[model samples]
Target: MFFLGCFATATAAAAAAEVAAPVPGYVLDNTEVREIHAASLKRDYQLYVALPDSYRASERRYPVVFVVDAGYAFPVARGIASRLHRHAGMEEAIVVGLSYAKGDEGVYSRRRDYTPSVPRNGGYRSDMPGRPAAFGEADAYGRFIATEVFPHVAAHYRADMRRKIFVGHSYGSLLGLQVLLTRPNTFEHYILGSPSLWFDRGVMFDREKAYAAAHGDMPASVFFGIGSRETLAPGKQRSRAEEDADMVADLRDFHGALAAHRYRGLATTLKVFADEDHASVFPLVLTHGLRAYLKQK
Candidate 1:
């Protein structure tokens, strides 16, 4: 009877343990978080950083890859970089995920912070529905990156300020383009995936024109990527301007425009993945973009 009682007790204990809530998992190793407040925008932001496994033992400075849309991109980039460095023979660099503004993440922060210009009549567009009514604050956000993020990163990590790489997608890529056009020196290499050139009726073209008009030379390398299925197919039952962006053509036009300038020290590459759409192109973009980053190594 005692043996049966003990067996029953043990079985109950095992079942209880199985039903217990699982412990929280910390997936990314050798990673850290840094907080920096934007004074101009009165917003708090966090930099989700992943360091190379060799970071601790080595005293050498490493170029940093800054990935925007951290909430979605951080873990992906971290895992890809680690895998590439370990098996794919790619060089390792520090990865920084630029997160959205805390407490204002979902609908407002990115629209406001990543756009280069604000539109009239509530600044909402059919192309990018569900966007906040107020946006177009990329200038201030760029300032935050330049003035605050730069200093913060420089002070804390062994980041090589001279060789910063900027990674962005859609609106994030649009912000990267804003910085690239206005100040090409901000990031030496740019991985701009599926940019929303349709934003604000191509206001960025004017910005590009402004850059070309003022500058004799642009010193930067850009990797432009898109997907074959980003455009609206006739039978897809589309709605609104979201499916009408024709992002593939936009990607080519932007690449062609950058190439046509033929500026000194400027180089660009474009890749379109078959059987993928805007939603699924980011990983390939990173894979190829990091391969392109090998030039800097």
Candidate 2:
């Protein structure tokens, strides 16, 4: 009886050990990973590049879409791009996923890199991994993308510089706006999804005002979308009228301002996805937003 009990215990332990072991990493088809040293940001970034199916057969240059928050969104973006090209009749493009270094401390780099202005009270909430601190380094992040990332992609791949697109969600969308307003020509098209325009009590509105005052015209194409249910109150919470995070209203105000400004040579579109919340709106944006911005002109 004692010997049988010992054998049973040993077998269970072995099984548990086998179950807990880490599985091998799987590679995505048509995707490659590259690490680039960004001097401006003083860190290394991992880029997940997804090439189009026809890339190897043709000499034609392809449009490139840079997807922020690549750690989570890279595979989704690549899959959407491929599907759209294959069935939806949209133009094929190269998809690039921007990610941070492995085992990064605190994991606050996304919040630091994506926000334009810090909260006045010195703290903010972030969807990324880590508690937020006083962080507003979008300028430095933009510099890294333009100087280091863009150059590297252009040199290695046949990317069309004039047809570049940028896609971002939530805080990532806010970063895209900073790039659009400050460096207008960095990318020809911008797809901003559920931007956190309420951050810092609408600091981005002031940015728009400054841009209008300094420049007579802005030249770019922009597409913005938000969830219809984003304005709804959270579980057992107060209504949007009483909430501070009314994203729907903020997005409407931003879009209104852009339309009112009527900056020369600028094209803009806004869409609200019905029955979708903040977190559920990204895949729709990835599909429809790509088609809206990447349509041949």
TM-score of each: 0.87, 0.86
What 10-residue stretch in candidate 1 is worst by lDDT? 119-128
Candidates' RMSD to native: 3.9, 4.3
Provide the lowest-lDDT 10-residue window in model 2.
Answer: 235-244
Over the stretch 226-267, how does candidate 1's per-residue lDDT look in tens digits? 999888677664322444667887778778877787888998
Report the CA-based lDDT of candidate 2 relative to the real structure: 0.85
Per-residue error for 134 in candidate 2, Å, reads: 4.4
TM-score of candidate 1 relative to the true fold: 0.87
Put down candidate 2 lDDT per residue, 201-277, tens digits, no spaces: 67898999999888877798898988999884666442222245678878888899888888998898889999999
Model 2 clashing-pair count = 0
Error of 2 at 241 (Å): 12
| Candidate 2, residue 114: lDDT | 89
lDDT of 1 at 250: 72
Q: What's the lDDT for residue 159 in model 1? A: 89
